[model samples]
Structure formats: C-alpha cells, structure tokens
Target: MYPAADTATLLIDGKWLEADDGATFPVTAPATGELIGRAADAGAAETDRAIDAAAAAFGPWSAETAYARADVLRRAHDLMLERAEDLAVLMSTEQGKPLKAARNEVRYAADFLAWFAEEAKRVHGRTIPSNRRGHRFQVLKQPVGVVAGITPWNYPMSMITRKVAPAVAAGCTIVLKPAEQTPLCAVAVLALLEEAGLPPGVANLVTTARPEPVGERLLADPRVRKLTFTGSTEVGMRLAAGAAATMKRVSMELGGHAPMIVFDDADPVHAAKGATLAKFLNTGQACISPNRIYVQRGVVEAFTEALVARTATLSAGPGTSPGVSIGPLVDDAALTKVQRQVDDAVERGARLVLGGTRLTEDGLDRGCFFAPTVLADIDETMLIYREETFGPVAAVIPFDTEEEVVARANDTAYGLASYLYTRDLGRATRVSEALRFGIVGVNDINPTGAQAPFGGVGVSGLGREGGVEGLDEYLDVKLIGTAL
Candidate 1:
C-alpha cells in the first residue's frame, strides 16, 4: 500500500499540479502515532481550481454516450480489483482499520465501481405517449454539472469511490475532498482512474489542513452544482444548509445509533455472533453499524453470556496484524470519547459485563486502543443505549415483547440501519415492517453492498448512496414536448 512518492500527483484538468499554496500535510497512523507521509494541502485556490475543472468538463462528459461512461467505469473497476491488496494495506496504515477489513473495504469500494459501471449504461429516458395527434413528449434525465463530494475518514477509500463512481456514472464531473486523516487512498483512486482512461477533471482530489475554508469554497462556488457528504449529523446538517443557500442539490449519509433486536426464538449463539460483528466491525466506527442490542428476556441471559465470551476473546492489536479482530480507534479524541461514554453509562447504573478499559500495553500503550466492551442491564435512559457510541462498545438491554422492542429500537432520532434475529417467520415479518430504519437485516450483520440502496432515515441524513437511486442524486429531470 506504499505510495511511490513521485506518483502522488494531483490530477486537475488532465494535468498533475501541486497545490497553489505549496503546502503539504503530514498523515499519521493511529496505531503508532507516527508520520506516514505528506498529502497535498489543497487550499481555497486549489479547491476553486478543481471546481473550475469539474465545471469545465461537465458538459462534454455529460453529453457523452452512456456506453462510453460505462466503459471507463468498468476499466477503473477492473484495475481497482487487481490492486485491491495494495489499496487495503494503504488503508490500514492511514485509516487504522484491520488489514483484512481494509482488504474488504478496497474490494467493497471496487464493487461500487463495477456496479455503477453497469448502471451507467442503464440510464434511459422515458417516452411519454402524447394524446394529441402528431405530438410527442419525452422525459429525460440530465447530469448535474459539477459535484462536490465531502467524504469522512472511516472507510475512506470506499466512501470516496462510492460517491464519485455514481456521480461519474451519471455523467457528472466531481471535486472530492477526502478526509484530512486519510487522503492517500483518494489519491490512489485518482491514480487508478487515470490508468483507466478517465479524462482529467472528470474526477479530481483535494486535500486540506482546514475543513472550514475548503468546505466553504466547495459549497459557496456556483460551479459546484451538487453536494454529497458522509459524516456526523451535525456537520451534515450544516453542509446541507449551506448548500441550500445556493440551492445546490444535496445528499447526505450521516450518523446513526442502529438497533439490533433478537427475538426469543433466535439461536442465542448465532444472534450473539451477529451482534458482535455488527457492533464492533471496524471497531464500531461504521455509521450504520448496530450500536445497541435489545434481546427478549427469554433469551437475554444466554445472548449476553455468549456475547461476553466472544467479545472477551477478541484480540486487540495493530490493524496490520493478520489475526487481530479489532484495531485502534481512529485517533486520540475518538478513544477518549469512547472511554467517556463507558464511564458515563456505568455511573448511571449500567452493569459492565465484559470490558470497560483501554489496552495500553504491549507496544500499544501510545496507540488509541479501547477494548471491546459490553454492558448488560442497560436501560433506555442511558446514553450508551440512546446515543451513537462510535467505538468498540456494545450495550445490551432486555425486552419483554416484540411491540416493546420495536418501540425502543425506534426511540432514537437516528434511523440509519438496524438488525433483527428471529427464527419465527411471523415475528421476522412483523418486526421487519415495524422497525423505523432505512435498512434492516434479518439474521444478517452485513447488509450494505454496491447493488442495494444504502442511506439513512430521520436525522440519519437525506437520500440514498448506492443502487440506481444513487445516480439520481447527481441528475436533473427535464421534460420536452413537441408537435410535428
């Protein structure tokens, strides 16, 4: 996953250019707190340049045949898949995900490229049969000019590719601002696109030291016609509001406190495994990952026991290690936040069933590492159950009935993703429809993919990110009528 140093070039208008500011920002690994490498610190001027580039190419790119665009995406996808292993290690070093998970992210990200590549050829206009003689009506979808994509640190490669691939698939050019902490992978993506024969300005990357000025430049610029963001709900709201000032088309996939409900008839062991993976995947940093578990009282004890055993056995180490199940938090602040959450929950009377402390030994003393923690006997009033604990922590609560579980699961303001485990078809059917999440999994932990429509509900943010619905975010509908 190492960069060739000389190849970390910024692609603008088919040319590689240094940030006009002539600045570089150092990237640090969360596992060792050591310097990884420097990424170009794109400033206001550079952001403006990228936007201009995107705007300049929008007309030509949008007017191109869908087959042409699909061809480029397919090439990019094949190249990305071929280099998945290298990209995975690059992500592990910069993003602090386990190497295996990093590989999955690279593969997952590439799948979006492949999926959207095929989707590009499927963007068809609708013919509206006119009632009037010698008159014809047609409704067509046109690509929005330039898209400003703001991606988060978690799942950096996948997030950037997910947004940019669909936008390009819809024939839109893009100016992408990858999170400051993990911008290298975005650069690598641009490299692959360059190799795949995407003309310059169709996809551009910008790295920055300050989020405010760069974000403002992206939002305030009229050339940037659409805004897509994935991050905290608070930040997403602010971006959405700012984009509104210019009436920019906007889509957001924000925060979540997803709920996992296990019915009485579910296998306790299977339910526990799902809960563990869903909660602690990427050390629980995923926006849609399940945060709270509500088990029926009949199976609560067994589920808790199995969960505790599984969570306790998880080995916390560097993400590059082969057998490690969990890795360090993204940074020091995230580690502190998770610790504060556990402390607050325990102070409020939740019983700590497994882990509650950070591991600060065995060369991991300085790293941002928090042990996989499980708290049982948690109540609805507790923050751990009510808020998004974006860390390696799981809080479990017991419920009496399906109605009660559904009510409690939907109690939060965020309705991003949820999980349910039930052997009874009646319960599964009734509960699946009863939950208030945008995406729900029945006896499954991993539900998101390139083919499925992925997004959030409520305060979770607006619009979908994957599937055909995703391409719509970067398009405009136009109706034309004519009489012959």
Candidate 2:
C-alpha cells in the first residue's frame, strides 16, 4: 500500500509507459528503508520519446487561447486541493518530511496552479509608439516552446508543480524529469493534470536514478527550448553551461546558505521559535534553511535558552508517526554529511549546547536519524558555518553592532535568503539593504509563496520561480510592426 500498483511506470504522451528496456529503480522509505516500490528507469531512448512528445504537443498547446490554458490549470488546482491529503501522505512516505509539513506542501503546491491559472489570462501584449509615421508597433508574449524540467528529491511535488504549472500556463508544453527518489508523488500529480483535461503529449514525465545521462537528452535536443531545474549549485552550473550550447532559456534555482540575525530589540522567545521552525523545517533539507544564526550579544543567552528548549520538544522518527516533528534524513549520504559537519564544528571549538549524536537507539537505527543539534560560538572558519549543513543542525554566532553583523552575513558566496528580527525599524531596513541575499524577511521566516517572486542572486542561480517573473521565464517576447 505504499503507492499505487502501477507506480513502476513513466508518464509519457498522456499514457503510463514502461521503459523500453524494461529497466526499473527501487524507491524505499527513508524512515524504515522499506521498499515502497520501483519506478520505471528511463534511459536515453525513453528520454528522447518524452522530448519528442513535448515537441509534438507544443504547437497545439501554445496555440490555445489563454483562457483555454487557464481552464485546464484551474481544474488541476481544484483537483490538487481535493486530493491534498493523499499527496501529502505520498510525500511524507517517500521524502521523509512530517505528515503535517507534507500537507502544507501540497496546499502550497496547489497555489502555483491557481496563481498561474489567473496569470495566464493576463499575458497581455503592449503597444509601442513607432518612430515611422503610419506604422504601429506592438510586443507580444508567446510561449518559449517545449520545456524540460529536472527537480530534486527534497521538494518532490511543489518543485515539479512550480515549474510545470507556469510553463503550462504560459502555453508551453513540458517534459519533466522529477528526482528519482520521489517519482511516485510526481506520478500522482501528473495524474491530476491529465484528468483535468491536459491533452496527450502536452505534459510528459520520465523517472530514472541516473539523471545525468538521461537528463542530458533534454538539453541535447534543440526542440527543448528551455530547461528549468532546482538542485545543488554545482549541478546547476553544469546544466546552465550545457543549455548554452543550444541557446535554450534556462531557469536554475540552486543552493542557498541563508542567514538569520536576532537583535536585542526583538522578542527572544519569538525569534527562537522562528529559528526552530526555519532551521528544522524539512529536517533542514530545504535550500532556504537558515544555515547561520547571528545573535546580538545583549540577548544571545536568552535566545539560546529558548531555542534549545524549542528544539528539545521535537521528536525524530518516521514522518507518519504521531507527535513526530522531525523525521529521518533522506538517506545515509545525508546522514554522513551532517555527521561530518558536526564533527568538524566540534573540532573547531564550538560548544554543542544540545543533542549532537545519531539516534540509533529507540528503533531508529535502521533509518538515517540524527538528533537535532545546536552549536554555539561558531565562527565562519567552521564547515557548519561555511558550507550548507542540510540537516537538523543550527549554528549560532554572537555579534555586537549592526554593521558587524551585516558584514558577517553578507560575507558568503551564495546569496539566496536572509532573515532579521528587530523591532528597530531603522536597523532592520539598514541591515536588509546591506545583506546580499535576494529574499530578505524582516521579521517573518516564511517569506516564500506562490504569488511572490522566489529566487536568489549570485551563485544561488538565475531566474525566479513564482509571481509574474516566473510566468515570464517560459515566455519569449516578439516585437510586431504593421503599416497602417
């Protein structure tokens, strides 16, 4: 009962398909390492078929009226809400986020569909004054054509929908390759789109463990005019470089090392609670998780105490278990990375203020389990502060003045999201301006939404995922001039 009986198949050309080579890959529960099921392991041959399908469907899909596209997206949005619980369970079972978080993710994911549905109707063209007499000039927004998307396992559903919805809304056809680990959820979501009147070949999906060679097929074909991806920064750079050969438009949402600064004027307890939510959300696997937490010296002790207390309450276990706020890491590799960071932090003289060991007792030995950890007096030299600790670990560094903290926070190569909690509006505004991140939350930790432009600057990658900017990524502009 882990997933549907036909989970081990691909979605190509509006039909569930088996890999031509009959290859399959195993998908296991992150909590128990139990075999959920296998998914079709699409190779280059199957990959080409999906791309061909998207190319075939692009003409019809892009030619449809904006209202027609909106109708299909709106129906998909309603169906997403109707099956929210089921999708949540599928995400929790495969991706290891808590069921509660999973429920929230699907709801959030559905918003993209709804937002883009309305946005589709508003893809208005603008008229331009022509320099020549008796001539009219206008600019048109048209779909960029066949789009290829590759998403990571951390955000199985939302990432896929965020890319697919806008592309579909913009009148472009899509051939999506979701992360291999979480393909079932992709299958379930694609089913909704198909049921909601998405025509055959308008949207296609292929799953495989080896995304490199298979995903390269998407970039290799000139018919795929755009490539949208969300993953590590290193891979994003590679994909961007690959797409350049064919001059395909690429949207890359890559790595992030977010910073959260807690000033003395802010409520220590409130900031601590927000830190807990932001740090341990999705077991810190999110790209926008706060990697470094800066505390003003005046209230460092109070904030630390409250943060430890809040973290202590979170129980790590299977995502579906009752009262479990935290769940296993996605796999052993993630666990190893967390362990390495913690070890390095300890070796660098940081104090472990709370739990830091692996939770092997109490029936969690089989899965990848690490206790939620906190390290204080962390410096920028340490790996926990320098690199992304994509686990349930928080790094705390104490600071004094606003200028000093702003410099410290902006002293990173990757600039994605940053947060600051301060009642002093002047300080908040000043520090936010100084920070080099794309998205800054003055007092709120939850800064991203379906209607907001979610993206980053610098090595964090290019393009936005939400809002009107996201819709524009799948569209190309054309200038038309006519003699009157």
Candidate 3:
C-alpha cells in the first residue's frame, strides 16, 4: 500500500477528503511500472458535492474586483515557482516526460498563470453608438460560471494550468478532473493554489478511474456553466454531445496529425534537425507534434539520412535519468499502438532506415520504451501516414512540388498544427497561408507560448487556449441599452 505522503486525496469545498466510499486507485510510474502512489477514486456523489461547492462559491468569487482576482493568480504563480522542483519530479515520475522537459512544463504552466493574472484586469468592454437620442449602448464582459475542466495525461501540469488559470482569472470557480493516469501532478498543483489563498470552493479536484459517475455528472449538471476538455477527438465528440443536452458552453482541444514539410530550398541538415526535435518532443505524444514529414524529392535522401543520424543520438529511459533525450510512452497501451503502426508501415514496403523496434536499455525492460524510428518511401496507403502516430516514429514522404506538398499536408481530417521550412520568403508565406491548420510554424518547430492563440481548425477541436482569445473562452459578453 502507498503511504499517505505519496497519495493524493480529494480537494472538495476547501476540505481534503476521501471518497464517500473510501475508494482509491493506485498511481503507477510509467517508466518502471511501479506503484508510485494512490489517488482518491471519487464517483458521481462526490462530483455532485464538488459542483455544489463551486456553485455556492461562484457568486462571491465573481463579485470580487478583477484586480483582486489578479492578485490571487499572481500569488499562485509565485508559489508554483517555489515548488517547481517537486512538481517537475512528480511529473517526470508519473507522466514519463524528461526531467528537464518536465521542469520547463512547470515554468510554462506558471507563465500561463502570470499571463492570465494581467489579462484579468484587461477584460475590456466596448461602447456602441445608439440611434435614439438620450440613449446609450454598451457591451460588457463577465465570467462564465462554474467550469468543468477535463484534461489529458500528456503535459498534465500545463494542460491543467492552461484551463484553470484562465477560469480563475476570469472570476469563475472550477471543478477539475485530471486524467486518471496522472492525478498526482494535478494534486500538487491544487496544493499550490490553496497555499496561494484561493478561497474555498473556488477550485476543486476529483480523481477517478471511471469517468461515468464523475465526468458524466459534471457534464450533465446545469450548475456547470462551461465545459473545457483536452483529449482524443472520439471522446471529445461524445462529451460535446452530452454537454449540448444542457446547452452549456464548451471548448475543446482535440487530437491532431500535424504535418512537417521540408522544402528543397532549405538547408537539409538544419531542417532535419528541427524536424527531429519536433517529432520526438515528449516522445512524439504531443497533439501538435509532426506526424507526417514531407520532404521534397531532390533532398529526400539527404533529409532522411540526417534525420536518422540525429534521432539515433537520442537516449531512451526513465525520465528522471540524467541525459534522457526520450522517455517511455505513457503506458503499455500507448506502446502497443505505436508498435502496431510501425509494424504495419514496415510490412507495407516502407524502408526503416534506423530504429524500428522497442527499446529495453538502462533498466527500461519494465517500462514502455520505443526506439526513435525513421521510415522512408511511404505512400498514402500507409497507416502511419494516415493515422496519428503518437510515438517517436517519423514517416518521410517525397513531394515533387510545393503545390503537391500542400495538398498532401492538408489531406487529413485533423488540422491542429503544421510546419514548413524554406529560404524563399515568398514560398514560405504562400505555403503558411495555404496550410489548413490552426497553428503554423515557418522555420520554427515550437511556436507555442502564453502570448499566442493555440488551437486547431477542423476535427482538432474548437476554441483557443492562450492570449486574449484564451480569456475570452471563459467569459460571456452582454449588451445593455440605457436611456439618459
């Protein structure tokens, strides 16, 4: 049994309590498959209690001045920095991201808190001219009450912060349901908010293996005015349908099969390096990660060779290990999925230039580790080219022209993110506009920040999650007409 110190209890109505049935589930480290701790396994009744708490606290929290809310967020940001090391270790242990990357994720999460803190006071309204004399018209902005945030296991800390920070800054109370595999990180974050003096019921957390009772109740409850989620497109569609029954506001950041195009005009070595970094970041588990690589025909061979050389240098092991360039996948299921995709591709005439198997080095036999692989001669019929490969596998397809590459890149139903590299400014500008994605990067692999709008078009999901647009997701606009 995990000791109390390693476990995460529920936070409901400002009180740390266990489930009504005293139910709990084990939290295992993906890197070692060892039991790290346990989390409260809350059900519908507990979710209802948390919702009631948020409903009760919403009035007072929303009534406070925007600056007052900003102060609380700023305090939380400072506390996050104070606890960054502990949080980073926790994330690395459970979520299987590299330690350095985990620490950076904490900083990124804190940045969101800081950004939203300033944005709270800047939620400005507009004045409109009225046709009638002695009449004035204006639009006002206010928080959307009681939010239910359902976040994924990948990037656990930042995902929660991205949703929670904006909700809190906009003067809304929230009930957060983190992914079952990684609730410990969420608990760590909740502790910081409490220490930062967030009022009781303003923020609550419930962890459970089953989403039925907890997640279902959260979506169905009318008191929960807005629902935000980051997960697969299949699950998002189901949640959206359910939330529609109550007509609650909904924002979702779903799955993606992002394409990375390397033009012949760009430096082969440079493009290859950037592509490798983008494809292997977070072990290629990110939604915006490059899944399909389109290299121009003239440089396909050179690009593929350089990509293999760079990828071969990446080390795979437990995230806590010192020089781990790649960490284990989140679980056995993820590992199996990646394996099946790679196997299918190799069987279908694709050449594996470098790694094409699972890794079991450095005590990684017990963990879910996959080798960084590169495949070439892939056509549209390959599964890795069509589906989203959420692993460290790069499938490079050759393109004859810019128009052909654009068409190939936009062939998928998902359009979350895409990237292109070319020295020709005209070509870069033209392709950037033509790509059907929410976020595009030209000569830049990582374009995300707290200051930009991050979201996708098509099946990638609805709404944005950063910048002024991010704050707007948690607020509602009202128009008023007054006679003077």
CA-lDDT, candidates in order: 0.87, 0.91, 0.92
The TM-score obtained by model 3 is 0.98
Query: How far does residue 74 in candidate 2 sit from its true spot (Å)?
Result: 1.1
Q: Per-residue lDDT of 101-177 in model 3, one digit per residue for the tens?
A: 99999999999999999999999999999999999999999999999999999999999989999999999999999
Measured over all alpha carbons after superposition, the RMSD of each candidate to the real structure, in angstroms, is 1.6, 1.5, 1.7
Highest-lDDT candidate? 3
**Which runs in model 1 stand beyond 4 Å of their true positions?**
1-9
lDDT of 2: 0.91
Task: Find the 10 residues in a row with the least total lDDT in model 3.
Answer: 1-10
Native-structure RMSD, model 3: 1.7
- Clashing pairs in model 1, backbone N/Cα/C closer than 3 A: none
- Lowest summed lDDT across 10 adjacent residues in model 1 is found at 1-10
Looking at model 1, residue 98 earns an lDDT score of 90
Off by over 4 Å in 2: 1-8
Candidate 2: lDDT of 290? 99
**Per-model TM-score versus the true fold:** 0.97, 0.98, 0.98
Query: Candidate 2 on 1-484: residue-level lDDT in tens?
Result: 1125564468778788878888888989999999988898888998898888898999988899999999999999999999898889899999888999999999998999999999999998999888999999999999999999998899899998899999999999999999988998888888899999999999898989888878789988999999999999999999999999999999989999999999999999999999999999999999999999999999999999999999999999999998888999988889999999998999989999998889998889989999999989998779988898889999999999988999999988999999999999888888889899999999999999999999999999899999999999999999999999
Candidate 1, 1-484: lDDT as tens digits: 2246533446677776666757778888988889888877777888888888998888899988888998988998999899888899989988888998999898899998999999988888998999999999999988988999999999998898899999999999998888988887788888888788898789988777788988999889987889999999999999999999889998999999999998888899999988888888999999977888899999999999999999988898888987888988988788888998899889999998878998988988768999899998889667787778899998989899888889989888998899999889888889889888999999889888999999988999899989889888888999999999
